[model samples]
Target: MEEKQIIIRGRSYPLFRCHTLIVGSGAAALNCAYHLVSFGVRDILVVTERLGGGVSNNSGSDKQTYYKLSLFGEGQDSVYDMARTLFNGGAMHGDIALIEATLSAQEFYHLAQIGVPFPHNAFGGYVGYKTDHDPKQRATSAGPWTSNQMYQKLLIQVRQQGTEILDGFEVISLLTVGEGEQKRAVGAIAIDKNKASSGLDSLVVFQAENVVLGTGGPGGLYQTSVYPKDHLGSTGVALEAGAAALNLTEWQYGLASIKFRWNVSGTYQQVIPRYISTAADGSDEREFLNESFPSFGKMGTAIFLKGYQWPFDPRKIENYGSSYIDLLVYQETVVKGRRVFLDFRRNPAWKGGAELRFEELESEAYDYLHKSAVLFGTPYERLQKMNPMAIQLYAQHGIDLAQEPLEIAVCAQHCNGGLLGNIWWESNVKHLFPIGEVNGTHGVYRPGGTALNSGQVGGYRAAQYIAECYRESTVTAESFLELAGPALERSVGLAEGALGRVASPNGRIWLEFREELQARMSRMAAHIRDAAQIERALAEAQAQWEAIHRFEFRLEDPARLIEYFRDRQLCLTQLAVLHSIHAYLQRQGGSRGSYLVVDPQGSASLEQLGPEWRFRPENAELRQWVLQYQFDSRTHHTAWEAVRPVPEDHFWFENVWRSYVNKEVFRDSADSR
Candidate 1:
């Protein structure tokens, strides 16, 4: 392992070359190079350090897409009943697919005839509204930063469609070709983060035949989230250069609420996607019958397509309705514990507006309206008359999202499986291609605004399937440098010195094993999880991935060798979210997404506890009857629920189509000073 003959501008290269590059600049790599320069392919290239930081980069990138209604073979109402009532309010995924939840309004009127603006009124038309994963009313946004105002307007139509952005460039490996059935994928070996001479060369290694990752997700391993900071993890550097990443076991988590003197980049991402609350003793309207309502799984997959069933329990809403009971019922009036006001004094959405119960709209900008009328006690002459972006983000960074009930928690967004493919996104290697949030085409549990409608229909279907694999590849570039020139000379001879320094104890045992895997995923799969905290977070994620294979950054310092490729991608994406929260914590009979659930006569032993369960029955019921027929039909949930797919005795797949169903897109990240 020692091949480093570098050289760039003066020629002498060949560390890796496959071609079609594209790491990410968000909106699934600028709508996969504006659908590979509108299907003509004017030289496609897109590196990244910036550009909508993944998972609908907060939602802009030319007003993303997601409107429902397809009917896939007249299944009538079912991406599992719009994921159990408008997006997994009760953990959805029962092999979700009724033809990708009925082709989301033909991919939202084809991304509003491609340019995306979206916001229209005063007779301009098209505002349909109604979100929670559609039944009709549809979805569209441009204001409140619809994914950063449709990615600045698609990075100015991707630098006026010439395509070649670059930004910071990091990528490091993947350059394979030929060995096992003539392996494929040609170029990639980059680094340049501003390299010396600045002609971009901190170790220039360029070679390409085909590669596209749209690197996003893995949410900075986690500590807290709302994203928008710097979001690194380059899809764990393209699954440590081998690819394969399917639903690295569903890592999504949400708690994004914050108020106690507002901090997380001041007032949550741009007001929790667009606000609401009615509390004051109504406990934000009895937290939909006292807590247990957390389900943004694809705009709430139409509350299970409107039938709604949910009854399980994870301590019935953090034990009786919480965010502290929507801050003591709606907008204030606690008394000794402090939330005060007895009158919303003519409620502008709990008196501030984020559309109180979805649109009635009024309070246009009262920046925490005098600390939410001084924490609901009101009267300081209505807090110097109406507060404005909470008195200018509290006077810039002083934070006060309405008086003070904001300290939300939930973390780890994104990484809903990665690599692996079929429905045209490609990946078992070969010409490669991973479209948006490192493509796993939303496997485990993403259902809200479907990662800006699967990076606008998987970057316009990986730009018409890498332009029909480059008009049917006859293959060249010296047969992709004699097929990825010996896997880029054995990944630059496993990088010479083989890099060193493992113990940071494997990055402090992956940050105390991601804080005990976010307290065993807020307790075996939050929102409510069971089967003994999903067999004790899958036996503490197999002892936190055997201490992340005793980490040792294979030596090198591109910022601690990309945290040694994010400590083996947060231990293989936390062993794919502890084996998909031990298959929804051994579901006895119910649950498929929001935070694991399943128990009803399925003893799920490890201590057993089913009466209806408030929590405690162990080993998540025989690992949900051994992954419902062990990945029944070879998984991607029976190929995104088009069911009946996995039938070729054991591996090497054949027919798996599944596109974006009741889309639960959380693929997010962010950073700041």
Candidate 2:
């Protein structure tokens, strides 16, 4: 590594040079750095706000799963079969799906070897189970902390590899060179939070051959989110730098506890807690589920099914599945302006003031409770009987589930779409790669834990590609300086302008803008969307963005400055999401996957009425299309791209033959044959 000094506005900053610069500190970024070292690539630098700050380390539910092909099942399962399942999951591209599936088993085993304690049987086979949208039993876990375990081990591996990490440095801009097809990532501009906090300006530049983005998802963009509060992803920065984003309209939303910010699926739902809604003063309590479902059995069955069907899906509404519960909760909270809670102390009251009993549940629900030996107790006791850790986990977080009702709501869980990339995880901008939640790998609906697998696979692929193509020697001082010049100037100007802005009495604070953005996005874009609502959201988001420039901030407080930058990024992401949704609605694309476009007129129940109903089957298409968005200098553009099907050569036989010929039978076969 080499360091050069540059003068910016009478202040000198250090320009560090590296082979690769990764902008995140989660599982994906650590995995990419580890693989880069394993492939003999040195001089890698990882810049992040904090180590172990992303969702991978901080968020999980009871039994968080890692989805992959079944290694030990009753019948034979191939990678092709897994690929087919992934391809048909939602509106995903077949090539990316196949790539993820093919590498899944290898990545799973690699994690196991490197110390992920995936549960095993007495005969030494990995135990598996079913997940949402998964046809086979391919999901496995090491309790609720599966992703955290992966992150810890990979963090150790990354440290052992001697990768340089600059913590508390926020990357604000990506520096690119050339025009159109010739454009390539040269480096990035980052601000040191520690220095800024001490009243010393420290703007550092990293001159690198490659930049990998694994900054997780835009968790800060939503008011109601399961993502960590500080995980402000770099998707907006990439988009502003002319990187294309795919399927921004598609996202996953589910019920989660607001106080602890944890998912309330799996064991939380399986143990049939009472769904209660109350007014502002905590009076006029109502057993909402009893009113929504036809009978106590139906409500109980839906609660049990919610363990598997965690995310909200429109199709599930018609099938009497659990997603309808999400709709009912949403209508209660958002539509009727009330608060919803999950009480586990007792059974819910029926319509006629009759107490709901365990005997009233359907066979599927009752049998599971009987099998688990939890049939004769309250929901809290049943949860203890089934998974004692579920109760204890929340207790550690200061929420005693047994003693109190957990405050919960339908919140944004994951982004199915992000920075658009191919099988290699490289963005359209050369030398810039996005992995983990920052990369839009999943389409509309993804099987649970697919995000974890996608991050691993993406990291492996990106590292391999970078090792083979970009090297430290390829990045010259002149080239980096040339590319970074304009970006540096632009960033400095923005900072100076922020410092010079006059405080206005009417100007909105970052928190105010953030709350407004979250409220609008949650109402319009989360589970239900329509053209008119989306159009209004776009206009509102744009107006907010414009208004943000007029706001003032204290130049001495670095945290406030970072929040200002984050506000811009969040607003950009919101606008992109709105644009993508507007385009999809314009094409008359009906509700598919997590994105539900409501049909106003054709529903029977309260859950199916209003803006939450689905379009008729006769008017919808079987095949799905992905929406792409790009921001240029003057305008933002969006278009729809039809998903590509799996190629004929992707068959099992062809893959097996290619592997055998390439590695075993014929060495250097491309020349020999």
Candidate 3:
């Protein structure tokens, strides 16, 4: 790596030049850097706002899973079988699924080899179990902090390789060259959070041959979210820099504790805690679920199913399914304006009498509890017996689940869709690879813990592609300086406008905008959707975006300028996502993934929920295509494209050897669009 200074707005700012620049410090970014060094491409620099603030390090659930090919089991498995399983999840492209499947073992073993500690038996077999949407037992875990373990181990490997990482730098722009289809990603521009008060010292620029974006999801887009608060994500920069996003309408929303921002999945739900709600002043406490569900057995079964059927899937809403519980919670909290809680301190009150009837419970719920020897106690006792780590985890966060009720909301947890990436994880912009949650590879319904596997596989593939095809910087120092000039000027302009402002009542403008956008998203575009409201919300988002450029916020502290830019980017992301939702609705898209499309003319999800709960069933044919959007210069262009089919490779030994040796294997650019 080389460093210099470039004059922007009559001030000298630091300029860096490297072969590859990584824009995050999560498990995927670390894994990419580690593999780049192993692949003999060592000129790398990783820039992150903070080292340990990402979701991979800070967020988890009960027994967070890591899905891969079934490594050791009596059931037979193959690469195609896994690929088909992933592809059948709807809206997923087959080629990308195939690559992920084919590399599952390699990446899984890589983590295990680097000390992730995915458990194995005495016979040295990495065992597996079933996860949501699984046809076979292909899920495994070390503990609740599975991704955290992966991040730690990968960080060790990257540090051992002497890779340079810049902490406290938040990337705000992707520096590009050329125009139209000829445009290429040359590098990026980031702000120094620690030095933002200073004029020239506040900005840093990188000129690299290739850029790996592992910035996770747009976690800050919604008010109700389980994503770590500090991990706001840099995807808006990529989207602004000519990257296309796919399936932006698909997201995973589930019940999660709000105060500490932890997923209330797995054993947390299997323990069958009591569901209650209270008024704003903690008055009017009532059992919300008991009133909605017809019988105790049905309610207990639904609660138990929430352990595995964690994500609120529209398909799981009928017949008093597990996701029906999510709707009830949503109604209690969002619709009725009350606070909901999971009370593990005592058993749910039985309308049938004081004594609970274990015999009357659903077989799945009864058998699982009976087999585990936890059928004879209260929810807290059952939790302590089944998974003590669940209680200990909350206790660590100062929320004693054993002593008090846990507040929860149906919150946005993951985006199954994001910036579009091809089989090798390269985005529409040449030399820019979006790995991890930023990459839209999962489609609609991914198996639990598959995100971790996808991130690992994406990093490996991006690194391999970079090592083979994008090893050298074609643009020279002077040329890079020339290409980065426009982006730098814009950054300087924004900074100039934001810095050294007088303290005013409007100083909280950014905060107000944040609250407005987050609330709008949580209410209008989350688990429930109304097409008319979404259209209006899109217009409001656009107006706010325009307001941003009009200097709506005055910053008393220049340090707050970082947040200014972050929210500025977030505004654009939110706009793009809303636009995507509107476009999908315009295309007659309905409730399919995690969200529901409420159509008054359609049937009610449940007759008792009233006409407002009416939602249209999914248009099954839409699953054959993917929704893609590109935002450029305030223009939103969205279209539907047929899903890419899985490729059939003939493994003729001699021909494969020839392609591998001559580097023809890396020459396929079919899906780079």
Residue 108 displacement in candidate 1 (angstroms): 30
Give per-residue CA lDDT, model 3, range 1-673, as digits (tens): 9999888878888889899999999999999999999999989999998998999999889999999999997899998999999989999999898888999999999999989989999999999999999999999999889999999999999999999999999998888888877788898888888897764478888889999999999999999999997777777889889999999999999999999999999988888888889997899998878787788888888999999999999889888899998999988888889999999988887663563567778999899888989877888998998999888988999998878899999999999999998889998888899999999998888898889999999999999999988886699998776777887788778777866453656645678888899999999999999999998898899888887887777766666778778888899899888988998898888898898899988755568787678898898888889999998876989999998877677679998899889888889553544
Best of the two (1, 2) by lDDT: 2
In candidate 2, where is summed lDDT lowest over 10 consecutive residues? 664-673
**TM-score against native, each model:** 0.31, 0.93, 0.98
Q: Write the per-residue lDDT of candidate 2 for residues 501-616, one digit (tens) a residue.
A: 42434455667777888889888888777777888888999888777665533333444666666777788888888888788777767777765666565333334354446453
The root-mean-square deviation over C-alpha atoms between each candidate and the true structure, in angstroms, is 24.2, 3.6, 1.4
lDDT for each residue of candidate 1 in 651-672, tens digit (9 for 90 to 100): 2223211212212111110000
Error of 1 at 527 (Å): 5.0
Strongest candidate by lDDT: 3
TM-score ranking of the models: 3, 2, 1
Greater lDDT among 1 and 3 belongs to 3
Look at candidate 2 and give me any clashing residue pairs: none
Model 1 CA deviation exceeding 4 Å by range: 1-18, 21-28, 31-42, 45-146, 164-182, 186-208, 215-243, 246-248, 251-373, 376-416, 420-436, 439-474, 477-611, 616-673
**Residue 367 lDDT (model 3):** 93
Better of 1 and 2 by TM-score: 2
Q: How far is candidate 3 from the true structure (C-alpha RMSD, Å)?
A: 1.4
* Candidate 1 local Cα displacement, residue 184, angstroms: 2.9
Report clash pairs, candidate 3.
none
